[model samples]
Target: MVAAMVKSARKPARRRLSPAEKARIEEIFHRFLSEEDDPRTELNYDSPYTLVVAVALSAQATDVSVNKATARLFEVAHTPQDMLALGEEGLIPYIASIGLYRTKAKNVIAAAKIIMEQHGGEVPLDRAALQALPGVGRKTASVVLNELRIEPAIAVDTHVFRVSHRLKLAFGKTPDQVEAELMAVVPEPYLVRAHHWLILHGRYTCVARRPKCDQCLIADLCPSRGTGARVPAVPEPERHRR
Candidate 1:
């Protein structure tokens, strides 16, 4: 069929990145580290327990929105014991604004109960332990580990996926593959902070729909320069509101 021929033609055009391209990607990463603050997760949590809860609530939701929801939730329930005592019903109103609230509420309550019973009411630092809990995955575990200063982890969220591929830093088809590629290629010194830097960059500059290429710090290093269609500049008043 004509469609099959076109699909085959498109495949070879997605070039495999070369070694020099990989090195340039590292330079771009260093540039970000030098200019940006020591990056941290946007989710606001006072302790590991609260962090687990916040990340659980953050699925399919924005950190800004999750933080707003959890500000009061954390104030009331900072520990697993506090959360369990609050119970699923009581917790509902606090996290109601987030998506999948009922399911998240149930999982959170179950995980909190397990934390209190099995881990001395503290969030476990190990990846396996964290992943065993409800609503926690590799990405969530990586976020927690990085935030808590655990080393050699790179959590590939939406931002990291987009930015890494566009920059030819990691040509992965899935989040797992991207994480593995980044872990192998990114220097050990940059591993812990890389997630935050890429995330912040993707969120603010190399966005999925409308990349701000003119203002991007690593624009020169990016390989997908013309792939993103040009967008009209926003008026000053509209920009300020955003």
Candidate 2:
């Protein structure tokens, strides 16, 4: 038991950024948005209910993977009533490909019941009401709200947390703290789409193991740009070829 406790207390290694590094990160984010189109989530959802369900299933999963599962799931059940009727047992096959399908399906069903019985079969627009639903947290609510074009909110996921720290956008140790810092600092215009931008950047370019730095538009503003980082480098053929 003691050995297990000691092992549990040992935290995984993580990267840290300095003040200069943080400044450079913000600069990169700003510069990237300056020339590019507004950012959006890759997950395809037609309504608020679909967006919330997609986000819930997205924990510790990929957007592409979630999208694949939801593509079929949404077809059969787009609303709370439809989802509740489908039931956890029935919903499993639709989303079974995802990481935690059983639990996600259970939560989705329960939340759907609540939405139908309590909220009159409509997705609530307020954060508090949204949070009261099963498996729905601030990050999930933020995603729904932002997608619905409501108030500006920052949803901190794995990509957001990794990218934010690496770029020094928000240095807090936890996702919640990082989210709060981002909300306080990021300009209003950028807040709603900021989560999407960061998630996409981290997903395709500033990746976890091997970021594609050479193709990154904001590499000039990154402190880790040329630190011999393990990130993937532009292929020699592609470099001059481009």
Q: Using lDDT as the measure, which candidate wins?
A: 1
Off by over 4 Å in 2: 1-27, 228-242
TM-score of candidate 1 relative to the true fold? 0.85
Measured by TM-score, the strongest candidate is 1
* TM-score, predicted candidate 2 vs. hidden true structure: 0.80
The CA lDDT of each predicted structure is: 0.76, 0.72
Candidate 1: lDDT over CA atoms? 0.76
Report, for all candidates in order, the number of backbone clashes.
Answer: 0, 0
Cα lDDT of model 2 by residue, 8-74, tens digit: 2113233455676556656765776885657777778888889889988887577778999898889
What lDDT does candidate 2 reach at residue 138?
Answer: 68
Query: Which regions in candidate 1 have their CA more than 4 angstroms from the true location?
Result: 1-19, 229-242
